[model samples]
Target chain A: EDQVTQSPEALRLQEGESSSLNCSYTVSGLRGLFWYRQDPGKGPEFLFTLYSAGEEKEKERLKATLTKKESFLHITAPKPEDSATYLCAVQAPKDSNYQLIWGAGTKLIIKP
Target chain B: SAVISQKPSRDICQRGTSLTIQCQVDSQVTMMFWYRQQPGQSLTLIATANQGSEATYESGFVIDKFPISRPNLTFSTLTVSNMSPEDSSIYLCSVKVQLSTDTQYFGPGTRLTVL
Candidate 1:
């Protein structure tokens, strides 16, 4: 079965701290990996999509990179406003159906 | 990016009752999906709402439990039948405008609590 796993279920970072969140996935045929930021009591907001190994995307102070086995979300000098849950999801090729395999998500708290 | 909206932002319900959540998108989208999320847990795809067709449910979900209706390209409804304590969750609706980008825009979500 295809699955997506995110590491460090919870993290606490002081303002300006830089860190990286990990999302490891095992799929029959990888199509795309997505990153999202979800604030409390709200739906997820789109972040980045990595299609292949070595692909990278950036937004503001955040960057996402993908490899064959895993994807990483790197936060640079995060602010208190950056505190939120980061979600990772993977999509398999057409053969695996159109469902997206989602990770448990990483809850990051940045305190000032 | 598409803007999605869901009715009944949050609700408290009694067990055995049912609730129908509505999802609307600002623009006509090609794909619409429904998901359930327990507190502090990951999202589980319930089904894909296809316009003018029956929804495609996931492995653990059934059409009888999560009946979905897509009357048009920009509107859909998901009815949770025979609710229980286990059914208490945050339901979200998402839209995909373009398949090539693989980007999904989500609505505010409906938080349901069954007692």
Candidate 2:
């Protein structure tokens, strides 16, 4: 079975603090890993996509890195405005309809 | 990247009633999907809306309860039939532009509250 698990269900950090969220997965054949940021009452916004191990992508203060079995989303000097639920999803070879297996997501709070 | 829009950002409806959510894209997309999200939970795929064909539903979902329509390449609709309190959730629409890639862009979801 292909599944995705995100750790640290919720995190509280002071402004300017940095942390990394983990997204571990078990899939037969990994096609791609995606990261998204969703705010309250809004849809998720695309952040990054990591296709292979040792691959990384960055946007503003966020960086996403991928491995064989997991992916990490690192936040640098996060501000209060950066607080949101971070979602992780993966595409596997078995999903012929282009469906993605999703994780529960990590709720991040940046207290000023 | 594609721009997507969903109608009726939030609504309050009585149980046994139904609500139809519309999703429109700025450009023609190859794939469109509907998802349901409970508060503080992960997204669950409801179905895939295919243009000019019947929508493909997921394992736990059915067409009768959640009918979908894809009239063209850039527009689709998802109707929640005989909605119940358990159906109170955020229904989202997403689109994938390219088949070779796996990035999906989402629209501002419709927040449904059933009484």
Candidate 3:
């Protein structure tokens, strides 16, 4: 069975504080790992996609890195505006299915 | 990235009534998907809407309960039939863009409350 697990269900940090959220997975084959930021009562916004091990992508103050078994979303100098639920998902290439296995998500609270 | 929109941002409906949510994409996409998010929970895919074929429902979901329609590459609809209080959730429409390695773009979502 393919499963995704995210650690630290919730976190609170002051403005400018930096931290990393972890997403571990168990799958048949890893095709892609996706990162998304979702605000309360709103849909998730796409952030980054890491395709292979050691791959890394960044947007603004957010960075995402992937390995064979897990991925990490690192927030740098986070602001209150960055406070939201961060989700991680994995897509299996061999499955040829449109479905994505998702993690429960890490709720991040950035206090200014 | 594709721009997606969903209708009826939030609605409170009586139990046993049905609600149809519409999803429109700015650009044509290969696949459109529907998802359900219970309060404070992660997303769970409901079905995959294909352009010319019947929607493919995920396990634990059925077409009879949640009928879906994909009229074209850019539009789709999901109807929640026989609604119940447990059906109260945030329903999202997503599209898989051709470029960027099949990444999905989601709409603002329809918040449904069944009472």
- Predicted structure with the largest TM-score when compared to the true one: 2
TM-score of chain B of 1: 0.97
lDDT by residue for model 2 (A59-83), tens: 9999999999999999999999999
- On residues B8-91, what C-alpha lDDT tens digit does candidate 3 reach at each position? 899999999999999999998988889999998999999988899999888899998999999988999999999999999999
Q: Candidate 1: lDDT of A56?
A: 95
Residues A1-112, candidate 1: write the lDDT tens digits: 8999999999999999999999999998888999999999999999998999999999999999999999999999999999999999998865545558899999999999
TM-scores for all candidates: the values are: 0.97, 0.97, 0.96
Best by lDDT: 2
Show the colliding residue pairs in model 3: none
By DockQ, the better pick of 2 and 3 is: 2
Q: What is the lDDT for A53 in model 3? A: 99
**Candidate 3: tens digits of C-alpha lDDT, residues A44-85:** 999998889999999999999988999999999999999999
Question: Between prediction 2 and prediction 3, which has the larger lDDT?
Answer: 2
Better of 2 and 3 by TM-score: 2
True contacts kept of 1: 0.79
